[model samples]
Target: MHIFLHQFADNAAFNLRRLLCAALLACSVMTGCARYVDKPIDAHASSLLAPLDPQQISADTKAHPSTLLPVLDIDPTGPWNDMQIGLIAVLTNPGLKAARAQGGIAEAQVFAAGLLPDLQIGISADHPDSVGVVNAYGISAGFDIAALLLHSATRAKAKAAAAEVQKNIAWQEWTVANQARLLARRLPFLQQQQALATDAENTAQNLLGLTTQNVDAGNAKLDDLALRRVALLDTTERAHTLARDIETTRLSLNQTLGATPEQRLPFAAKSIARDFSTLDANSLFETARSERLDLRALRDGYQSQQAETRHAILAQYPMPVLTLNRARDTTPIYSKGASVALTLPLWNRNRGAIAVAEATREQLRIEYESRLHETRAEIATQLTELQRIATQSELLRQQLQQMQPEIQALNNAVQRGDVALVTYETARAAHLDKQIAALALAQAAAEGEVTLELTVGVLLWQ
Candidate 1:
């Protein structure tokens, strides 16, 4: 009975020890994990600049195809909507792709910069043992606290800069898409003008042929026939030039859409409805000032510089280093020691470095102010120009409407054989010129609207 009791006590003690060891091991693991608990400041700042996950980036890229184009649901102008044409440019433009990639790259840098520097290990050995000399082995491991703090600051700045750059990139891409859409809309009108010119030339040629037949029959003079032929040839040459100009315009539009130089896009033939009125310039200027990406980027840059300056000033203070050492000798000697060390700033007070940081910060401040001023001026200028163009366009439309009656009167006179061929031709040409001018005025008005809208951030490209 006694032996059994003793064995049982022994087993219980062993179990207690085992439990204690397990508890200790668990506590140690927890402590190691807790070492990574970020400070409140770091946590707050890091939260503000969380890196975009791979999945989120992929999703954004995928969503672009649907949203890149603008949808004009009310317009029944066939499959070639404004949105699809805009998408063709946004999806294919290499500049936009590169800008987005640059943003991603910047985001990666921010992630990298957030990480602390790695601890390094150094090892050395020496032996002077010709006849029983001593041998030594030394190892050292250390972490750079300054580097950690500086790197964190650098990462924060980089992140802010990257975000600003991304905004600019997005704005630029949207601007490019807007320009392409405007050009696409203009293509149909240009083609219409070419067709009109061709018809005028054909009409003139028919008149010349009639005059030549009259001369052969001795009913018309040779001089009159020659004059008619010269007029017809001139009209034909003008039509040819107009065709060439249309081709050039088409090539330009194709290039903007990322198509080959020789490639042509088959746009839907439609006329722009002239129902749009002038917008408030003052309101647009205010919106642009508030939303312009370049200005936002400049503001971000200024803030980042301020952070760097603070960090630089903070660096003047030296960090305390703690070192522990242990040594063992084969001759039975042993030693161990721990020491705290700090660098002295007796001669070099870091004044020069501080001055440099202050100067740089001032420069950044000036630059930011300058940028703000420039942005405001540009917005005002663009707004004024838009207003001017809108007014001119309205005037031209009025002129075209007033000229239509005279042109009709001349046409009726020619049909009734009450006017000479040249007089009728000249009147018709003048009317066509007025029509061309009206089309040009309409195009200019549309462009002005697009520019104003874009500047004010009413629309965005993918």
Candidate 2:
């Protein structure tokens, strides 16, 4: 009898140890299945600003159809138009690319939020020697119903945030497009201005040389020579200033097109004359209110915050988790049951979170209204400026028309030596300057038109 009792005790101890080991293994498997992945930083990520490859953009477009474009479909090479330049900037601008990545992150979070929670299992064992009980183990699977209840709201918020990102990107694209159009329109005038400045410099240099020769030959006074030299210096300085201005303008245009500074672009298109005769202020106001991308983003953000606030209010209640449990003991005693755990809301009722969410929602509401007012004001301002510029441009055009015949007569007389060459050159330079001013005004009006279209979220120019 004693030997049998001892063997029974030894077997019980061994079974207890096995049960403990099995419990530990189950826990380890449940928790350690997902390993950490090391994401090594790429050393070449700084090369994003390198010249864009059409093929790479195409491949990326295929990978992330929503985030990028097939630039290869467009003429990725030379002579990019306004829309093409905007597209290239959208595809290749580092800031916009990063914004696209951030939107993807929000989309991924929405996907994650919509997913059902993972099943949970619990294991327990009792030592027979200490507790005088048989070896036992229990497994439980459960999920948080509170999380399930909040899933819709969470997913809505995530999706709204993603929409906001897209709208923000559209606004950014509009800004780049406006800048590109303006600069491209201004390019010809800038080139013409530089050329005129160069001509003036050359004429002044020639006059200075003639005056110096006359002075040396005792045919002109020293005062005349001094005056000619001063004129040459002034014209040279003006030429140098204009050259710098042309270089700077080219650089800006290249940057807007996402090209290298040295890259030559086709800017031969004349200044665009946008007709505003059909534009009604009231209609434009309504359009801006309805279609503005930034305003749409603000609305999206407000919707997201509303959902978050709802979720926060709902979360103040008890978070109940339902568990399905199974247990087995060494003595063939098996059990199956269901249980529930509740998070009592006695201490923290989420009041602070609710307050914060409510305040944020109100703030967004006011912000939306404020932005609406600002949008209207901005559209009005642009319209007024465009009108003013249009009037000035028309008057300048008339002036140019009136001056052309006089200038031609002057040119003919100078060719026949009836008038001084210097006098004719001065008149020609004045006319060219007027032309440049008119072109600059047209470019400004074009930019205003772009801004108005961007505000209304449509291509009015087309």
Q: Estimate each model's TM-score.
A: 0.71, 0.80
| lDDT by residue (tens digit), candidate 1, 1-462 | 223322332342334344446545755785555356556756565543443233332344356552434532322233444445555566556577677788888788778778877654333333333544343333344666677657766777777777777777767777777777777666776777677777778767776887888798898899988887887887788779878877877777666665666654555534344333344556655666677666676677776676677677767777555555544332324455655566677766577777887898798778767866765666566667756666776787787788788778887988899977657766676677667666766666666556655666655222
lDDT of 2 by residue, 192-305 (tens): 767777776777777777677778889889998898788778878877986887789889877765667776655553545877766876788898787777888899989989
**Clashing residue pairs in candidate 2, if any?**
none
Residue 27 accuracy (lDDT) in model 2: 72
Q: Residue 297 CA error for candidate 1 (Å)? A: 2.0
Best by TM-score: 2
The local lDDT score (0 to 100) that residue 270 gets in candidate 1 is: 41
lDDT of 2: 0.72
C-alpha positional error of residue 52 in candidate 2 after TM-score superposition, expressed in Å: 3.5
Q: What is the lDDT of residue 149 in candidate 2?
A: 86
Each model's lDDT comes to 0.63, 0.72
Q: What is the lDDT of residue 427 in candidate 2?
A: 73
TM-score result, candidate 1 = 0.71
